[model samples]
Target: MVDRCSLEKEYILSPELKFKSEIQQLNNLPKAKKEFPRLSEVPSQVLQQTIKQLHKGWEYFQKRGFGAPRFKKFGQFKSLLFPQFQENPVTNLHVKLPKIGAIPINLHRPIPTGFMVKQVRILRKADKWYASISLQCDVSVPDPMPHGHPIGVDVGLEKFLATSDGVLVKPPKFFKQLQSKLKLLQRRLSRKKKRSKNYEKQRLQVARLHHKIDNTRKDFHYKQAHALCDAGDMVFMEDLDYRITAKGMFGKQMLDAAFGQFRSIVKYVCWKRGKFFSTVDAKGTSQQCPECGEEVKKDLSVRIHDCPHCKYKTDRDVAAGQNIRNRGIKLISTVGQMGKETACADELPGAGVIQSRQVSQPRQGKTRKPKK
Candidate 1:
């Protein structure tokens, strides 16, 4: 259907018209016993749902400036949606669909008493079949942690997170640890003939390994995010631009760190728990001295921040955390009363203190004339 719709130039601009035309064509087909037997056997609602999905894809493309919809080949389409489903009358543990019979489901957790299942989507992954059931229920918000401090976190490639309270959290580099095994698997896969049974087996093995790595990373992120949200009432972090940073020399390391995922987890977890979460400009968080507001320029090799003006010294990451905390506090003080959703500024308070003090540059001159 997606392929047929894409071929029509007129349908490219209007998905609704294309959907209606497709439905009309399906309805006008011959009877099941005579011709188009399978088409007639399939439920009308299922066909309509597929057409609705195609239309939705085009709508998304128009609104989000995404690429046009494309045809799904053989195994590419892994999931099928049943918009309407009900509890099986014969079996308590199965769900009845329109055309499909009662399918048994493995309930990992008990569903809430008052919750109602709205839809079910069955998906295939590797050799496993999974069902995703959407439900409607009333959910109560969790209470925020009663006692905790406001913390500023600085996420870095070296350390996963450096907190304002002199704490550092390190990431478990799951991919790096399994790189050798993955490389060996890929090499073995490359040696097999394409489309051969051995090649397919090796491909599945490689995919499972990748999936394991992803799952491990997600597990770590979730645990760390939960810990941070539970320990802090308000959390502040740097608003980093990962895309721009990924084009640099340490692109691989930056991507591996997965700071963006961690930030997202923290943001959502905070929101769900009624904790305050904020992001501050990261421009001078590392360079600017937290105590005296002096700009101390240093390279990445400089792990410690030694401010010449105030004679204050600390770990570079710790200094950055402190600076982030100060800025967050200032932002809250300025905007908290106004009930603003976000606290943002072009520059942190006292950021230009050092720059404003202009010292005269010494030049070579005639010393004799000054003496006379």
Candidate 2:
């Protein structure tokens, strides 16, 4: 369909101006199935969905003014989406799809008590095939109310993350650990003739290694996110575009750390665990002293935060985390009934104002009792 659209004189004149609907009309034509016999093998909805996916890319490109839609090369298209289902297609041990018969699957985790399977997307990663099922439950769950301990988080390439409570996590360079092996595989692959069986086998080996690195990094992110939620009821992170950081000298390390993915996972986990999550302004988080609230300028080389005004010293990341926590608390206090919900007495000052000049004393908050 993309090729056909590209050949159109109007599309060549202004590709950005065209949309998915125009191509969709061609997909609906009876001649489409005649031209592409393979189209008839899959369900009609799946074929239409393929066009929708392309349209989504085109739409995004129009809005972002970059990332124009491009055709997928051979073997690049790896997923088939069955968008809607009249009934649950998943059984105890297999998932049923239209046109395609039941395929046995090792169910990772059972669907929740009330959720109904709504859609299924079958994806291929290297040599493994997997089904990603989406479920729907007709229930409205309110967002977790701001309460209990509020903790701030600061993430970087050096330390995976530092919390306001003085907890530091080191980055686990998953890629770097296996990079040598990956390079070895690529070198072997380059020696093989293109399109040969040996080359294909070698290519799959390399792809699987890359997939392993991705899975390992993502698993680490989830574990860390859960750890953060376990520490505090309210989690606050700095709202910085890690993408900008990814273009710098240490871009490879930044990419390996995957700060943005970690933050997003943290937010999702916080919501799932009935905790409050938010992002505070990222500006000057490192420059301002958490103790005295005075601007103390420092270079990237300076890892320790030393405040002259208050004679306070601590890890720079931890201080930044503290600032993030303070800002988040202030934000909620002004917008909602934070005083009524929050259990901390020291934090309660003149109209929710945090006294940065005073020495902060750590007080053990009442451990939140679980609901019956």
Candidate 3:
């Protein structure tokens, strides 16, 4: 009964306490019933109860190990989609387990009402206990804006995002903030003897540092992604190449930020609300000129793009964003023209994939806007 003011409780437990207690519970299983008078005297009721207890313990063991009940490397993934299994217990922080009793939720904000309460999941993030309670609610669609008001977003290290509106969101650079602490922890871990308790302790320290880094990076990505989603009538952003592209120093930092995750979440939520999202190509969008259609051979150091023939100069990222928008609109138009639903990735050589290096040959920027 989650009528806004339901059984909402949480608590932040120490890593040592949570780890030690769970490990002990999972490892300490009851002994088999020896000296049974008869199979009937053993009591089928008792046997069933004992089996249930063992089943719960087995689940915990499978998730964490028998020795130190810590999270698995890949973590536990549970979903209530079992075919024959009729019931599964809700993992709320406040929900009492058999014999172990309840673990309270330490909520930071007041729970809202008008939502049908669903099961709560208790998760251990770093050293804290968090209860994620999913509520059943039907949220409606928002008002629509007219066309010609769509947005395009270009992402990079210098600016986290460059929108079609010419707004540049700067990267938060979270790793830079905790550089000293990370360096200290890494150095200490290096100094510790291998396979020793001290080394294991240092490893935990490193893990905590990494967890902190992840949280900070995620926070920034959420703010930026959310803002972009809410602002746009139609969104167009680059589908970043997670592999080979994240090779350089800055690229590595961007990857750590989980750019793909951020974009995916934003896109998903928007799609649910009936909004459109388009992931444009990354190739020539950055290099091609948006104005007079010239290939400006600009280095990363050169922030301002100076088109030689057209004498057009603007911020490189801004120009890039314009190109992304233009390309996306053109691609969308072409798809609509064909009366078919297709993807830009499917855009092949003779298909929608734009080609030629005429901008560099001679007429570079001198030529007026080429036929779109």
**Best prediction by TM-score:** 2
User: Considering only N, C-alpha and C atoms within 3 Å, which residue pairs clash in candidate 3?
Assistant: 9-105, 10-104, 10-105, 10-106, 11-105, 11-106, 93-103
Per-residue lDDT tens digits for candidate 3, residues 1-372, read 011332566445565553334335333432323332343443333344444544566567768866323332333322111111113333333443332345565555554656554444445665555656565568875643223234577877777777755677666667877888999999999999988889878877887888888887776665665566556545677866765656765576867656677778667755665556778888887787877777878777889877887887778897788777667655665644445543332332222222232111111112111122
Give the TM-scores of the predictions, in the order they appear.
Answer: 0.72, 0.86, 0.58
lDDT for position 256 in model 2: 93
Best by lDDT: 2
TM-score quality measure for candidate 3: 0.58
- Candidates 1 and 3, the one with greater lDDT: 1
Per residue, candidate 2 scores C-alpha lDDT tens digits across 74-148 of: 789999999998888888899889999899999988888999988899999998999999889999989987766
Model 1, poorest ten-residue lDDT window? 363-372
Any idea what lDDT model 2 has? 0.81
Q: Candidate 3: where is the Cα deviation over 4 Å?
A: 1-93, 96-100, 107-122, 132-148, 190-203, 248-251, 272-274, 334-372
lDDT of 1 by residue, 1-372 (tens): 344543435323554553345555455544432554677666666666777777778778879996888888666777778776456222357767677777787677766678778777778776567887788778886554312345678888777777765667665677888989999999999999988999989988998888788777887787777776655566789988788888899886777777888899888888887777788888999999977888999999998999999898888897898788667756665544434432232133322211211111111221111111
Q: What are the runs in model 1 whose C-alpha is more than 4 Å off?
A: 1-49, 60-66, 86-106, 138-148, 335-372
